[model samples]
Target: MKNIIILCFVCLVTISDTNSSSDGKEKCEGIYVRDKFHKKVVIGMGLNRPYQLAYDHHNHKIFFSYNIGKDDEDSFQIGFLEKGHIKHKVLKEVENGFAIAINNNDNVVYFGGSDGIYKQHLKSNDSVIEKILSHQNIWDMFFKHHLYFIAYPSQKLYKYEHRQNKTIPEHQKIIHEKIFQFAIDGDEDKFFTNETGLYRIKNSTDHRIFYEGPKVYRAIEIDNKGVPHFSGQNGIFVVNKKNDTLEKIAHVKNIFGLAFDNDNNIVYSDPHEIVKLLPEDC
Candidate 1:
């Protein structure tokens, strides 16, 4: 009877493994979403759960942050893919977080680390990485009229005046909730996301909730037409201004970060791949 029971248990384990394998195959090996204006292309592979994505328009490259190893043994590093190149290049291994910002006007790239933010000139012959902001840990950042970052620990938003090397006073209290990421529209309207949902603040006016959802991803961007799009485990979604409704554009799985390239194409990252959404005709 003991031997018979052992054989039954083994058979059950085999059946479970087969079902899990079939389910995974069904989830990953099919077309999940469709769009007329866009076709997806896989540009990166074999990555370790890449998180944030930033495009350098001046250099025509896409930079991404990911871990060098699995949990506990993992270290953060920034990698980039040059236009028309299949090879991935290591930009730098940061000591801390995975936030990256590019100042195309200044030809510089800024990355967040344990100390603060560090800058590297993209065009300069000198390949030195210099620390620009220290003491304050950064979660995520972006550059528009100025440098803006979500501070670590507090999770509040702050703007830095690089020219004067000081934090903007009025921007210190823009919102009450914790911020994860943000984007400024063409009209200078700011959109932020956190645990609660997406928020918008315009012209120093009161913050308005645009979408109420849980745990939106850190990736968000405004297209050239000023439409804001963000991603999460569900898929990529866009905010419809006509009636303030959320629309899912791509049904891709586990999208984590997004950025718009110079030609207005959308580039996004998932667990181990970077893909671009391009016009179908091309």
Candidate 2:
């Protein structure tokens, strides 16, 4: 039954985590990526293209998608950074994937591909279930607040509420339009980016515009302070609601993915080079 599958999935991940540790330290401890922000750290020179990043705090893993806009069979790959370095053999090759997210609770990776969104077991490197929901060709997704919100090119939104049967959770069309990238803080307030501008969704329903300009925002991430920060074609900017202006934070260009680390450090990428923003630098 579904309950038994859930139990086995959890146990396997836990055992894998336990076995991957050494000297009372996580296998990833001391093997973090060196900062490559705004610099020419071309980790993507060998790949086709990369986009979307998901950091799994529970297992100290980084999941990402590459080879965007390619055919489902040969265009995309689901990759990860583990044991303090890039590990190509960890996860199986995926097709038509544009974005990815990690369920830290279950040690699984949910990815959007040409067909639809699928959840895969990290420990076994096997696709756990076929097709989590509808909306073919998922462009992006986020696993936050116990819900999986995904977007499509046609401006459709789909979400799956947290449940034991995540592989087959009932999908809901909650948001009527599309969101390029999104981030949610502890307050459940979501900051999103679209073709028009940067926006905010508060109280789970009330939507408001944050910034509207010529800049095409690419990444949306919230810091520990409840304020939202964005990266885009120009550079990185943080919300300064008091002045109704976006405070420029970093001058990097073309940030394709963004997230806040456990220590509130910013982790982002140019869709090629992944970097961590340290407190001293930011």
List model 2 lDDT by residue over 136-234, tens digit each.
Answer: 777667676554555555645556664574544344444446666666755677676666777766656866756754357766655556657777765
Pick the lDDT winner. 1
Candidate of highest TM-score: 1
Write one digit per residue (lDDT tens) for candidate 1, span 67-167.
88766775777788988886688865467657888877688888986668887888854578887777877788877767788887888888877446554
Off by over 4 Å in 1: 1-34, 72-74, 125-127, 162-171
What are the Cα lDDT values of the candidates?
A: 0.74, 0.61
Candidate 1 lDDT (Cα, whole model)? 0.74
TM-scores of all models? 0.79, 0.67
**TM-score of predicted model 2?**
0.67
Worst 10 residues of 2 by lDDT: 28-37
